[model samples]
Target chain A: MTEKIVIGLDGTDTGERALAFAKDLASKIDACELLAVYVIEWSPFTFQTAEENERRHNRREEEINLAMSRIVDPAVEGLKAAGFKATGLVRHGDVAETLNKLTVENGGTQIIVGRASSDGFAKRIFGSSTQNLVMHADVPVTVVA
Target chain B: MKNFVKFGLTAAAVTVMSSPLAAQETPGIDERVNEAFAAVTGPFVSLIFAPFPGTEFPWIVMWLVVAATVFTIYFGFVQFRFFKHAIHLVKGDYADPNDAGEVSHFQALTTALSGTVGLGNIAGVAVAVGIGGPGATFWMILAGLLGMASKFTECTLGVKYRNEYPDGTVSGGPMYYISKGFKELGIPGGGFLAILFSIFCILGALGGGNMFQANQAHAQISGIVGDYPGWITGIIFAVVVFAVIVGGIKSIANVTEKVVPFMGILYVGAALVILIVNYDMIGWAFSQIFVGAFTGLGVAGGFVGALIQGFKRAAFSNEAGVGSAAIAHSAVKTKEPITEGFVSLLEPLIDTVVICTMTALVIVISQQLIVDPATGNYLLNEAGTAISTVDGNTGVSLTSAAFGASISWFPYVLAVAVVLFAFSTMISWSYYGLKAWTYLFGEGKTSELTFKIIFCVFIVIGAAASLGPVIDFSDAAIFAMAVVNIFCLYFLMRVVKKELSSYATRLDAGEIKRFSH
Candidate 1:
């Protein structure tokens, strides 16, 4: 069975670094498939009006399409061009929790994600998802700085 | 829609014109306004609180208690059966990664909690025990327990019938469920009921939710800073609440979703400390509660009185069958509507069962009531019950006196808590009021602005108005909401039952996937 390497991407320069690291690791391993996942943290706990709630389902579909076409597909195409068997997934949830759930469901052997670019007060208070993935992910997680 | 707007404007004009005259005629604006409000609200107050024929109890309390009991049995006590699952759902254990919502179960729960867990828990509990004695605490807990089932039923329907928009937003509550659920069942009166419910909800939002909050906050401030004109407090509250709510529901929800949890912990933690300090009195407190509940031991109106106060306060505190929480819980992200229902059971549990009970315990153990130790009876006043430690006090002041007994400076901390609690409740109710407003008038910028403007005006009105008619009218409006909402619940709860059983079957068979340990 081929080993699975899951790379978490956030459509940032750091995400490219994570992909590059995954590519390098895939080459070292004899047979491995690459799965790139990008998570959009959409909170369901928001308060919305009837008009807003009416449009929520359509808006969510648009977001997923936008993420897939504009973000995930382009990145996956890049990985494929770079001589790797790569697939991309777009999900809406907490970054770390979504990534871990995806990896476990997909039977990934290891995971790689980029460190958040901005280490400001907001990130300090909210905490970096990369750190969260490291602590909570079922699989071994590699955080690329 | 135009007519409604016109009526609102006329009412506003009357208030605005009267304010100047009242202020000019009487230097004491607060007293004058209170008198005017009392004059206006007196009849409505009597009508709402009128006792049932051949009974001393208000019919509305029986209405709520009976509805809660029926729901508990109809659902087979899902509150207990799914208690663990509800906790797991709140933790997002079964959440699908692709679910479309703006917040998690915990956030939704906290936001709903913020709305219900307000002045009712603090001042309302004190009033219950003050009148009904420690026995009221026992009945309050019982009512809270039964209320959990009502919360479970309405919230499930809230999510099930909620309208999910294309813009990643959601709107739900009794308005949607009554209309949609009734339509699904081929019922004819769904539209009328929805309209009626929306009207009551708007009134409730304005009266009980917004105005009452402003009124209470002003009262607390007056306790600390000498009596000032209420409009001053009202204007200040209006400005602050407007600032928060005008930012939209997300801004309102974000604040509540954060503040409510922290406040719950802080408030409950303080109560726990008091209970622990009075460790020796813990058993005695429970005995007093149990005895008071049955025999009305030294309490006014005896067992019936204790039972009435308990049920009334619990209904007021948790708002289980009121359908307001359905609006908040409807935004939860889950394909399984029953999961939101399960999570929502925690709302009444936290609000009435745990928090209200804690408040009652602290008051009971504080020995603040004028009880005669020699006879284990209350020192009765001319009205029959023991007088409050604080003269002429009914609500928060009584609770403050209770806490001030052990924690000398607790009243100061309580003042801050009251402001925050009032603020949180105001914002939450604004969202609720806004939803009902938009529902009736049709959703638009103009209509939305018009409703919000009226709501802000009520904040000022609530603060400046005397406690008599304003509070009574709002309380009546809040209970009036139940008349319509609980009626709908009778028809729609079977839908919730179906959803719950299906969810349960899937879970028991291990068909539900767990994403995390």
Candidate 2:
């Protein structure tokens, strides 16, 4: 079985690019699955009621589902439409922690991310979290600019 | 458009020439750095204790770390208790848009972060990791967390002691806090302490905050741009910084308030993408940092013992007691002193906890560590010797190379980030130094103009020169501020307690509410 390719999305513009790349790669590989993972962060203070909290949780889940539907599902559906196997996965926690965890849990072999075109002063004091992960990830990380 | 075209053309040329250039290259970059560092690493390793003094231990770092810790403990870890409140202060429950201050809590926070978060996070960590090891990250985080308390103390004092000009512009910082806050506390030594801190702040403004920031940036740009001496960086930076800084704090803050957030989001967002793509490495990163903190292999045979590397870096990262953040915090618009203190908590959280953590993790897990650890002893590219000192580029380049190992094109990403980080920091520090300059040199036209001229000139020198000596003195001055400021906090901290208790009472009464949804 060919390995799977996963594209992690944080609902940013670059994430959309990563999703497209993952879908194309899934098709190029003889046998591959595409998994979409999202990590949801919830502050313990925000929810005062269980019923309300349940509604909120469900709302967040739906939001992730919709995002997946837009960014990942279209790509996944496109792969399927092209006769390839692809899936979606989403989780929740701190961004770095969640993404790292999801990549390990999912059977993802190679992961893809994005970089920026402008390398101005903004990139300096504040580093690119995606770039940091790609640099240090144990697995093969392909960064798509 | 021309530069863009030129950049593209040049990039292509470098790629095409990489092989031939490598084969026929004659090296001239044999300038040595960290000489004191080398002395410490060799015969001085035992009695001298640390791997290097200023490069590693430096009395300034020692003082800053000590003060930050003392403030954290004395304040009863208030940084944690008031974390939410700090968030709200920026949300501005009490923020009057009609206030006389130059910026709001959020703008103030961003401006200050621009100053505190600079090349230090990148190269400073690299240096600490180079000398101290991965363990340095553990300390850096600890320092950043505790540094929040120090930040709180200084910022509260900043608001407590700030001044308003006749025309209604704001002038504040550690000078006001020390000279003024101390007097309000009925301390006899208030004037002296304020003056001392002002001196330190002035030194810090010029050295660490301004010059050091510009110096490292110049090194990085020149480092990557190739064949160009660092001076070219100085020339460009001098022009840009001089033009902007001459406009004073209003101009500086206006640009920073916008620039800081966008850059912060951009950099952190990029780091997130990298982490997600390389998610598996996260576990190993945590393991190494957690373990490295306990072992001495990171720094290897330091008299101070294990994890000093971590402490040194942490101390550098958060800059809790250094008093630089206070200058920015002083400008916050509020009558209630504690409001700005709450907002100040985010400094270490963003600069130290979030940003520094990401950089540390990246460096730790990079394949480069597979080759050398602790930013330990430089390896000469040609002869492969373990030299104590390296070319200036080694500090930042080490980090870039580690990042590039995973993302082949990541060096450019980091380079862009490095330049921005340095640029924002330079601007922020410029404000800090200006405040100090005005404090010492009588806030007149000539004082402002003269200080500015020198500051701009330093920028060029910083960019063009080798960073070794420039950074050393600047680093020293920053530490000195921490020493003086922490002493005042120790004596006058009861005032902070009263303020905190009163604020807590209001919070309990539900008088303090979030500003908006």
Candidate 3:
């Protein structure tokens, strides 16, 4: 039976590095299915205008497309080209929360994600998803530096 | 989460109750603030809203009326023709599952509606009716109908020239369109107009959107709970507003979208119930409106006063030509900009024609004001306006009196509605002000934060201060925005015309396909 591994992709070089490390680990394991998941951190609890709410469905679709094209696709392609079986998902939610749910749904045994990609002021003020996943994730989480 | 919010609110209520009972007596500061504001705004108010020679009409009112009339002719009355399509678009019939915008046609319209549909529909309408007589209702509807065309034109340009950032966010409104559209047409001074509009928007946002809402909310609260220091209500409002705004733009939109709809339904539903209950009087009330509109029904300002007041209130309430709706509409997701424009035209119609008229009908049907049976004219005070139901009065108090007359318990419900309406308007205007602020100062964390902090401070000031100067300045700022925005619209309207024509042609050819999903 293949061991399912969930990898978070953020459309950054750091994300690519995490995927590469995950790919290496999957090869070491006899049978493994790589699940590349990209989350477009959306908060249902957050405020929105009537306009934003009306277009919420369409915006959700766009966000998914944004995640798939900009983050998940490249990671999936890289894994597939490296001769591994892989699947991709684009979701709208809190990044850490969504990734954990995706892992449980996909029956993933472990999660691999990159370190915080940006050291910008915003990220500093609002902590990174990697830290959140590490603390709250049900499964084992590997943070690639 | 829900329990937490409930608990938090209970705590807040407790704090408000336990904290103060002594300050209401010394309203001296409030008086001084009012006087100071009155002084500052006094001259500008007269200058900006000066009546035209030989008429009671303000020149600013003429500016909007002329623009609305012109757009109506130029677009060949697109408001009527595309009215059906606009409704369809709002229903999400024409929306592609994969559109490029942030909000839907309906959401944009509703969001903008929340901003315009607030105090104006309630308090402003009462003011207009109280002064212009029942006849003002007729002129208001006319202005609203014509204003639809103006809304359509500006909103179309808003989407057409909107700046879509790489992060999938959008910046738009008169600022973007005036600058970008003019540049496209090889017209200079677009930058000048853009800056001017941004300045007015920021000022308007601070004054009308922030202070006025806070002041009104404080008044409502004081009416319910014996007066506290206005600053207390101001501080509370400022704190909540700050929290919501800090959560970002999505948070502001989310709250307004929900609260505005609920409040609108509550207020309008109450009005409908009153109207239905007084079915027999509805016809008589409307006849008064019609008669009063034409002959002024012996009210002061005669026929023209009613017309001017009605038009002014409608323009203020719906904001059709003020161009602020364009900012909200620009966020709508659509491949064709004109579709959003079509959707936007309904804003004024709903806000002014439907909602304002509902308010007017209720006020008229209440029989609270003294009316002469022989001439159907309201008994006027020395100043020549319909006498208030309450002594020394005007604004929402009069509306409250009317509603309270019909339903004894309604004043309590109305106080709640007033607070919610004021809150929603403040949050929405915060966004409008923020956008204009960013346009001038540039977008960054510090810049954004600075504007927001300033906004929060103004909320406190608005709540604490007297209504005179704060409201006057805000009114002037808002009208000033219209002055700059409408001026630019006149020049860039040809571009809007071209876009509308092309969009219409495409619609006729069935080239714009509706996505089933």
Candidate 4:
């Protein structure tokens, strides 16, 4: 009967903070089940090829796994250690849509992730993928710095 | 007279009625590009060679080839030994495809391959073989082999020093390793070298990756769209590329995963069809490759001199020790850096071994006998600049010519493929440069934005302006990066060796499990 929160994590530093806080909130509330989610970015390239793209995908998965292991795993483990229920999910499609899907999937109340992380490149000319995700995630969104 | 007019009108009408065919016949663009390359790269050929002046030091690549060949023998041709394993890696036996990291191994290879796999394989090898002859392919294969070790070392270091953010994002490459590795060595200039590497990377991205890519794309677009001013084509490409690049690595990965594969198949398929139809010529073409490599049949000078040209072309195309491919390999997602390193070894094989050979074979098979394989080069009659091709011609137009000979529709298809390949390559290189940029400068938003914007803008310049000096400077910067990067790799080969052995043991002991999901 507790209000469970669905948090969106795209694996940015800010997302890390949000996930950490969400785990704590879930442990305290006992009513909440934490959903750790990620959205895979797709473009024309992913849509176009079959086996040729797999070579790069494998390399990417290795890095992505390492990343999830570092951030989501610890938080997920921490919540479990405290006897709180936590489920981790990775979604492909647009970041925003996937995060929205997770909210409905979990009957969740909140989405948490990083704000526009400062890219050490050109500014004003670009927006972070996380920023794009935050702008569209329909649930009450929290961007942890 | 009335009958003649009717025939002329009918002919004109027929041409106008053909939509795609009409759109594809823009040889004018090829002519212009050929002229432009001659004006710039042609004149500088001797100059670029004059300064460092030794067939000796700067060309450590030659020795690297020797080293790689020796290592391959010592390890019992590990490239062949692990061939099956590499194939499995590509199959994602251990991959979940949806896993984190910016791209798939295949996509990463293509993305990296795209960056390394441009005209260098096509035009570069052509020039090398033209000047150096078939002996160049021998050296090229040799260099590529040695390049495997360098690729292993750099990619392993790339992952070893890589940073994974709390958001599950990763940032890595030579810049990270060069700086991090130096820090571990207690070297003072580590920071400076890292930044320098970054600057070189940015310059390369803009010039070689961005501008050059855009320039080639514009050439192709214009080929398809005659009278479409080069600048307009450049702007459109720049905007689209900007849109993708602004989204960062995932966006790049997302695009490349598809683009790289599509283009590779299209290119390879086109070449294969050409080779099949001309299957009879395969015998003679390869005969030239072996015979020209040693006897220097058509070359003016001795056999050794002609052989050197082949080596030069091979080096230019495969880029065995250049370290650019390492930048791509560093982005892989595995916990074991060596897995990616092993995967990294495939770049030269795919790029040089499979693709480059296809490119060469296409040209050699199609070329007229007057185009000598021993020194298969000549001056563009109008441009008066020395040019080379597998057939021993100078222009990318020659690539199209071969395509045209096999399939009636092939020239157009190949043109589109070349443009896409060049564009994807440039865009991918942009990321490599950006990582380096961030490495040198503080991770500030303004600095980041400025570089990307500048990089985007160069697409227009590359398309519209003179490529002569720009390409030279860019080539120098890229090759210069190899000098700096390889120096680090040589000193730090121990780390790569340790990782390689450890991973080998893991594989042997079944510590590394094959993937099910």
Which prediction has the highest TM-score against the true structure? 1
Higher-scoring candidate on TM-score, 2 or 3: 3
Q: Encode model 3's per-residue lDDT on A65-134: one tens digit a residue.
A: 7778877887888899999999998776678987998898789999999998878887778788998899
Cα RMSD (Å) per model? 4.6, 18.3, 10.0, 14.0
**Local accuracy of candidate 4 as per-residue lDDT tens digits, B224-254:** 5574656566666666666555533355545
Fraction of native A-B contacts kept, per candidate: 0.34, 0.00, 0.18, 0.15
Give per-candidate clash totals. 27, 32, 13, 39
Model 4 segments beyond 4 Å from truth? A1-145, B1-77, B95-104, B129-135, B185-188, B221-232, B246-257, B299-309, B312-316, B372-393, B465-471
Best by DockQ: 1
Rank by TM-score, descending? 1, 3, 4, 2
Q: Per-prediction TM-score, please?
A: 0.88, 0.66, 0.77, 0.67
Over B130-242, each residue of candidate 1 has an lDDT whose tens digit, in order, gives 88988999999999999999898899999899887655578899999999999999989999999999998998998889877788888888887898788888877776665
Every candidate's TM-score, chain A alone: 0.94, 0.69, 0.92, 0.71
Model 3 agreement with the true structure over B1-517: per-residue lDDT tens digits:
8667645644454344333223455657566556766776688778778888987778998998999999999999999999999888887778653242346676677778878888888878887888888899999999999999999999999989998766556778999999999999999999989999999899889887888788877877787688776877887877677667753435654555666677888899999999999999999999989988999877777998888889888887888888888998887767788888998999988998899999999989987667766865677887555553545446777788888889988989888888888888887788899889989999897798778778877776677677557656767778888899889988988887888889889889989886532
Against the native complex, each candidate's DockQ, computed on alpha carbons, is 0.33, 0.01, 0.11, 0.09
lDDT of 1: 0.82
Candidate 2 chain B weakest lDDT stretch, 10 residues: B384-393
**TM-scores, chain B, all models:** 0.92, 0.82, 0.91, 0.79
